[model samples]
Target: MDLQVLDFPGGKVAFTSKMQFISETSEKRVPCYRVLDDYGQQIEYDCSAQVNEELAVKMYTDMVTLQIMDAIFYEAQRQGRISFYLTSMGEEAINIASAAALTNDDIVLPQYREQGVLLWRGFTVQEFANQCFGNKVDYGKGRQMPIHYGSNKHNYFTVSSPIGTQLPQAVGAAYSLKMDKKSACVAAYFGDGGTSEGDFHAGLNFAAVMEAPVIFFCRNNGWAISTHTREQFRSDGIVVRGQAYGIRSIRVDGNDALAVYSAVREAREMAIKDQRPILIEALTYRVGHHSTSDDSTKYRSMDEIEYWKMSRNPVNRFRKWVERNMWWDDKREVELRNDIRNQVLRAIQTAEKCEKPPLSDLFRDVYDTLPSNLHEQESQLRETIKSYPKDYPLDVPV
Candidate 1:
């Protein structure tokens, strides 16, 4: 019996198809592709693509919702209403479409930028508001910052600040799911920058060796913070990382909502039915800063951002497809945007007025039994709050 080794770095496999196949002893596996060009036309892939009016409209609505939320939250941060914010300005399709393909039982391990997924997964606007504003109603209390929303109901893991950590966690979760003989899988989302981390490799290798059901979804938006993909890696893309793990992988146009949805739908099917871990590299671009904290202008030019905006706008491309199919109207689009904006504004206003989580709420969840040292520190902090001036925001009952 002979085993095939793919030398991705040495250029042994000819990178022609969405997936390259090697003649391993007996079994054969293949990759899937569905990419579209700037004109909303298929470019690199030519498989039988399927999308209908309902899915198209749903995708459009999700994209619009994400855009509206992103725009408002950025302004909220600017107005000092929120401590931190992250936007999925350009990568809307990659997040929402991929999420649209998952089951309610499937777990989603998302990085900070995939706020769109939660919203699409029945996370009400008010829940988003509560989480972002860190109001009394917030599930995590006031611990996580804006957009770090999670829900057990949705099977979406909480978004953590550390990069690439979710990859391994997703692998472990999938391992558990498989051990329990469940059909559900875990889809972990990460950025191209995260691909450089050791966690990415460890997670992929574990999933591959264990045959865990997980989807390693990478949004190759060309930048990892201020660094470009060329700087982060020299391989074909994040997809090749999947090849190294001997996992089935796909690459799609991240801006094309249909392609993204179709690719993920197929990937999810493979994951659940075959217990295969998949790596999907969505070739997209980040049209915004690394976050509200960093100025992209420091590292990239205005011209570059403008280039992606005009030519590769996911919203615009999807809108074009919508118009071409006559499933959407310009007047309705305007009205929808206005309605969403007003909805967000009202949610924000209500969330802002909601009481902050009780000062003691923070000390409750840390341990089964609080250590004396931590209890003392918590007490000292409470005392300091009690010592604040009457006008201070500290409303704890001392």
Candidate 2:
């Protein structure tokens, strides 16, 4: 019944006489921090001081813009104008508010659903359309599919389709900033499902060991494609995982815009100050299908989706907060929605009308000088197209 300290290879340990194991489930689960209630009323604390009229208005407006843009783009996919599309219907607050909290210098490695981050970084709807449509003027040269947006000028990395790949990459970037003594951190955004990937665990451990300044933003929207969080893991969500890696972690109500902004702002400060990683598990709902390819109703009930969409819609929630402060009104709401819709429509129309990238573009960018094999293939392709003119479209430049 005597307590004794044990020498261990790992580190110091406090010996205890009692034998106990950590339980998977706890009566007092990790609390999710939230600044506003579902009705958009600030409960225990008022965040109006930090979230001013101008900032609040801009956050709400950007959320609406993202919502509208998603709707238009999703429909465009349905109409066959674009190949594929994904909508950030309910998670608008997470995208816009978190982005507003960080400086432009901070690097962003986003998953596919983070279009709002690009929008916050001044990426126009035209750019979104160009990429989705894979038009001639598209920055990616029509290589990637829709929504794989990246802007070097904005310090945001191009989105990769592979799940959880950005997690470790963010840590590497953060480590580079640490080495350079730069005043910046990397923000890596991923879904709840991404935690299951090996990269996620590796990335967290690396960041903790290296004392890298990075924000691991997990948009725990309850689902990863068709799979629900119930199927992902059983350890009380992703926050505790961060604790296991010796990194700071917090869970916040992702639907609450002000809460997200406040949390990210403080997280950034602590991340850079301490030269460590911070994991933010944002508790929100995926109110839309995972992508245009998915029909969410097949896996989840319409009533379930409707509940989050109607009662806890992030955009509507923030709008209420903004209106309560007299920062928003119905006239502005109407104009904002209409103007965004028109802009989206015009962008889509122009993108659709634009030509595809030239055929020669396919061979460029890989190397300074094309290899003999590639040059031969290019010549053969040109000859084949000439022979079978009907097989190829004439619009692509020779």
Candidate 3:
């Protein structure tokens, strides 16, 4: 079929009968963009240290701290101390390095695993324990599930469990920032499985058309729960979808801290200066189970998990890079790990001992003035607790 044309008041519209498609064969052959190798050595181009020695060491330190924190908290969940938890594990570089590239003022809307971002922004280990235990000190007042962390003080939005919802929210926030002439951009993180959602398409399209200053960081970590990437999509991963929406995109070696840091730094510049969205597909593997409830051995081979864990450990790779730069050593590594483990353990104990939120907290935040029905319910609950103090000893007075 040949081209067809139609004339309109503003301009002529042309259409072609030819169908352009990215077939599975072509997608399989698409090359992933990578800067650093498994050993943290440059692959092709030199990605020299843009940050000084202190910042470089700090990034590596945070990654190790995250690793240790995840291990301890994951054990806590298994030991029945916490209800649930998710670990950054193999993707620490993707979390901390990209975070290192952003300023404190930049807004971060993260998926659950990007807790390292908040940690880098100074969200303390104790706050993590508080949220996990859902104690009175938790910022959400024991309202949110464990691991769904947020901090307005750090400009990080609270994580929502419903996948892909944050994409549009990030774009909307970015649009508002653009209108307000703010100097910061928004960075939203989601998994590869999130790309399958309608919200992902809607968010990307809206951001592209509106030229919103947002970065869509997709952590293509091999598995979406039990479903592998091969079963998830037939295209050349999530990065290609960005191009389909006329947005600039790149795929980076997610395990390599330098690669992730460099790509995100450039992406932030493009997003803020150009007022456009950028998609980053970080090619990494999820070495741990999806969450505490998940048993990955049921779906994946232990051998494959061990391979990624031993060979592509992001923390080890970055540590090697920093050590090569003469800024880190085994003594510092030991001291940091010991300190983090002790801190996490102490925080967990403290959070558990803290009291639960008062019953009134539930009715307080929903409305300015309490509704009659809720008021009655609150009163009845209080009366019941007052009458049966033995049965409701933990319940606090309104």
**Which candidate gets the maximum TM-score versus the true structure?**
2
lDDT of 1 by residue, 299-394 (tens): 999999998878889988888878888899999899989999999999899998888888777787788888888899888887766676564565
lDDT of model 3 at position 362: 79
**Candidate achieving higher lDDT, 1 or 2:** 2
Give model 2 RMSD, 1 decimal: 1.8
In Å, residue 277's CA in model 2 sits off its true spot by 0.4
Against the hidden reference, what TM-scores do the models get?
Answer: 0.88, 0.97, 0.93
* Local lDDT at 208 for model 2: 95
**Model 3 lDDT tens row, 109-175:** 9878899999999999999999998888889988888999989999999988999999999999999
What lDDT would candidate 1 get against the real structure?
A: 0.84
Least accurate stretch of 10 residues (summed lDDT) in model 3? 22-31
**Tens-digit lDDT track of model 2 for 347-368:** 9999989999999888977889
Q: List runs of model 1 lying over 4 Å from the truth.
A: 1-32, 41-49, 389-392, 395-398
